[model samples]
Target: MDDFDALSAMAERCFPGLETWNRDQIESQLKVFPEGQICIEIDGKLAASSSSLIMEYDAGLEWHNWKAISDSGYIRNHKPKGDTLYGIEMMVDPEFRGMKLSRRMYDARKDLCRRKNLSQIIIGGRIPGYHKHADKMSAREYIDSVLEKHNYDPVLTAQLSNGFIVRGLTPNYLPADGESCGYATYSAWTNLEYVAGAKRRFHHVIEPIRICVVQYQLRTIRKFEEFHQQCEFFMDTASDYKCDFVLFPELFTTQLLSLPSVDASRPGQAARQLAAFTPQYLDIFTEMAVKYNINVIGGSQFVVENDTLYNVAYLFRRDGSIGKQYKIHITPSERKWWGVSPGKKVEVFDTDCGPIAIQICYDIEFPELTRIATQKGAQIVFVPFNTDTRHGYLRVRYCAQARCIENHLYVAISGCTGNLPFVENSDIHYAQSGIFTPADAEFARDAIADECNPNVETLIIHDLDFEQLRRHRDQGSVQNWNDRKTDMYRVVYQEDEKTFEV
Candidate 1:
């Protein structure tokens, strides 16, 4: 944050009387990606600064101006999952120009590019010398002259000297820059250190990930501390097995309703009271995830947002970051008894192992949701359910298996066992948690990875091989994902109030 003023002042000095990044844009850049924003200080004085973002580069796409590419200098369009590093702005103080600061900054960018395993560093460098030769020659001719040492451009010459190669030219790149006649050179520096066939940004080579599915026993608990202890025990157990993820049953925290203060007879009131435990629920699960060094799908809990109650499942990452998925499909009982509102978006969460999605009990029944999730690169779908009867439990299990077959992905499900007698609609419980895979030559017979005994309070530990899963998706007896005829039929999901066909 302290770099904001220095950066703004430097921009003003570098391009005086021209539009430069403002305070808000600088703040947004720092907040969105601090690692991409670099500054060089000489003896506590700001000498130079540079801004960059990662994006999926497409050479065949039409070029956009600086404003469009950099999101008007806010860099809000930066994609952390992208493979290319894009330089948006680079400035060296006029007094520091001869000190080779620009070269140092470019070297820093090269180091970052190699460290991030990016494919290349690209930028649209201003042709600040174009206006002087506009009438005498065309833009391309001027570029040719500059290449032959007959002419020189301040920015383009510096970029070329720093190992960048000119790819093309961008017109009207900065309409306010009259010195360049609103032209900029499309340039790039390829990362020679980048390895071929390496997994791009935030992804690693496919490996077997161990998962622990907890069939939580819905017995009465006297206090939140007891619930925390139970949760920590499973976290400890999962960590002992070196599992990457631990899945819990949905609404397992409803055991808090067994307290004297919560009245299950008034379901709506009981749900609101249960929602009050959200803070503690998040704290304990997040702490457990970090302390045990394991990712935790802390199950679904009733949470109130904007005066509406929604059942939201949280992914407590081992790094202390939290991701969430709201249960998009609400059952009749949930709506009638608890007044739970349906969530609007289905999302895939990124993990060190790969990408996964959480589908609450009823959500798995809707094929569109899981289809969308898998289409968005989810390899595993975890369903945390709380079904009160055998029929309901079978519905979840069957649908989950079907999703695995049709999507060509893994589905792991767990549910609450025992009984929460004090909770009205949640009194009786039935579940047989299992991890399922597609029926193929490479998978287990009957397509079942592992299953726990029905209605038992136990956890199933199993390993999922992603490399085999990928091969199965590509070379299996049948390719369900690839065989989808999107031209004829498609599943669409609504995001940010916009419908997008998957």
Candidate 2:
């Protein structure tokens, strides 16, 4: 990567002791060892590539290593299995930039998912170490904006746009000065099949709950002004679809309102500027909620008070009152910078559609969080995330689907559209948003168009079928969410006796 020389020069502009390791270094550390790497070539050209790793760390980022894409959201409730994981590093080579390579990459990932059909896919994306310069938002937000438009979610203009779900961001996960590590958001899609040997009796008057998963084909919002415009558009679109509640990605407002031009020399001024911008967007979230008469999950942001930035996910009610969830799990930089405060109670509120619970990005990664949400009588869970690398985002997406199927609940996740910055080897974008419902055989095959896709906006709303959920829980035939062996779960989760053969 001679271009790395260019990156080296720019890096010199920032911190010391940071050097752009030569190709030899990358080869020695990655290519030779190939712990986590995948390449996709279409017609004699590199289309997409991915890589990742696993490590024991409290926070996730390593500044130079791959960010750990762990399934969050479990507040002492999600009992995760073993530490086995697959980290992915990807790039939709310049030749295949906007050609829906994400789906291809995902398909490749799924093939691997099947081969390694252990549990779930975990992508610890831009945890700093893997891609150091992931957060370089130039004063020209348009530069980053350009990135989003090219690969960014661009509103609702992509079919696979439903491929990604936004889980809220990690506290202080997004810092200024071209450096930050965030949690991966999740959106899982599996084939839905009608029960072959099924039984239904008293279903006469009431119809099955109809669900429509829609991903609007829209453009990316590069500026703060565009945020509200897109918001109104989606609100109206959802209304037209007669959907119950609408979803907005985590920190959706913050990304547009963000002022990335703080003087690196003066950290205080930068923090203050970001904080003011955050509040303005918060107000917008309230106004949008009231105007739309819908439930909008305000994305997480830096709520600065007394020099502290808290990672918070705000839920704006139809009445316009805001309910907040502060991210308790803080990455290292978060601890060093703002000292993100712990979140409040995560109780699902009663919405017109059904009972819902909201958790920010990292929160969803923890299976425990979703389990608790399901336990709390929540039929649906809304996760807002600021996903970074492709690997990190998909990890949670697959996990989300598993949770939904496991507990017979609905999970709606909205994540970043690649408007933010990230490390190298990450051509990550949420051009694909997602929705997973009652499994059907047809879905495994015909659900998503088996064709090369471009920018598309469609919804994944389908029938929730409370009757089906009841059946899934009761009928051993499907047993989708009914038969979890808690005893087996403890075998992996419980502490093992340390035996020493002295």
Candidate 3:
């Protein structure tokens, strides 16, 4: 409404004779409810505009035309506490039409619906391509043709892809709507995230993200079925608690070496034996993540790809997509006893909560690796570790704590607890899973959010507030990210593509 002139002009250009709003009409609507008026300006010029009003939804309501719903184009009958958002009009500059500005406007409308806790968004969408086939088919037949892929209507097709369902049709809705041929499709999109009794509310609180760490107990498995059930039990427990991400400890798959036929005497032989199950291992975790709709860091599994053994962590997304991050640094035992090769690259996975990086065991001890990951926009670092002694466990634990403080983000550590007496390389294990945070007043003073009792097989669940971490980074006692002396010293990866200037 503030840029009514620009919005009107753009609408006129986009739709020459198709019911463009004038100053008085726009002013009156804005006066009634200014919350529904939105305009986007790109480069000091108005590129798009969306106008809306609110109304109660009737389950058995008849199809409504634009004039009837808008109260003869004035929208004076808008209900302030309506449960549904009634889209009045949308306009985009001709120059920005093909740039997906309509989709952006639709996204904004859906967001507004959720913000207002509206039940759904209802709109009479114009079927612009109906006129071409008007003589042979009815409005309902035309919509069916478009749905069956026999014909297409640009407006209706785009709306359907944006989650709008065609409820009914109104013929001769707007007689002057030239492109639509006086026909409009009744479309509505329901907000599935809405709660039944929830009222319209606003909050700046970034939702608390919950994380679960699996203190996997090492034991011999007679069959892969047993391993699959064990994995599912942990994931189901975490998902029941509504944890966003579930993590497993490093080398947890080594328990498969306990099978009777596998030669588990030598470390190299055991790695090869585990590598044989890599395909089944991946399928199990990937399916688990998809079935449960949770992000899974399936620990570090040994893989023999192209005849080279590489220790890698697989991240499975809730959408059934998978990503792998290799251990960038290797230890002496890994190379000497297992013939393992180090990965030269690090990777990060993106989730709805935030971006995360997986640094396996020894790799977490290297501060530069975590630093690089944070520079690449990672908000959390997950360390899947395995240690045979308390000393080795402390090395990973202390370094992970330091990384969280230095990077100003959250860190989750998962490690194996029990010992595998029969398997050679997995003979002994000792660990405690813990979620770490920056050492700030707002966080746990000890930097440990939650931890399992030492040498116990358990699951540690903790809630991490990324918003609080962000606030700490912005105004905490010491801001490491902002206060870094990059001008004096910069750590650059040798194989990094970008050059660092210091």
Residues 387-494 of candidate 2 have per-residue lDDT tens digits of 555676677567767776666666766655543332211123453455554354423342221111222444444444455455556653456444666655621221
Go through the candidates in order and give each one's C-alpha lDDT: 0.88, 0.47, 0.85
Residues 1-502 of candidate 3 have per-residue lDDT tens digits of 5687888789889777876787888888888878788887765799988888888787765446677788766789888788899887887798765445666678789888888888899988888898788889888899999988898776888788678999889878789987778889889999876666766554436668889999999888788888889999999888767678999999899888887778888888789888889999999898788656579999999999899999999999876789999887889988888999989876877887789999999998988888888888899999999999999999999999999989998889999977777776678998988999999899887988998898988998888898898888888888887788987888777556666422
lDDT measured at residue 160 in model 3 versus the true structure, 0 to 100: 85
Q: Is candidate 2 or candidate 3 better by lDDT?
A: 3
Better candidate by TM-score, 1 or 2: 1
Task: Please tell me which predicted candidate would have the highest lDDT against the true structure.
Answer: 1
Write candidate 1's Cα lDDT for 128-151 as tens digits.
Answer: 898899998988898888888898
Candidate 3 lands at a TM-score of 0.64
Q: Which candidate has the highest TM-score of all?
A: 3
Residue 321 shift from truth in candidate 2, angstroms: 3.4
Question: In model 3, which regions exceed 4 Å deviation?
Answer: 1-81, 84-203, 496-502
Could you tell me the TM-score of candidate 1? Answer: 0.61
* Count of backbone clashes, every candidate in sequence: 0, 100, 0
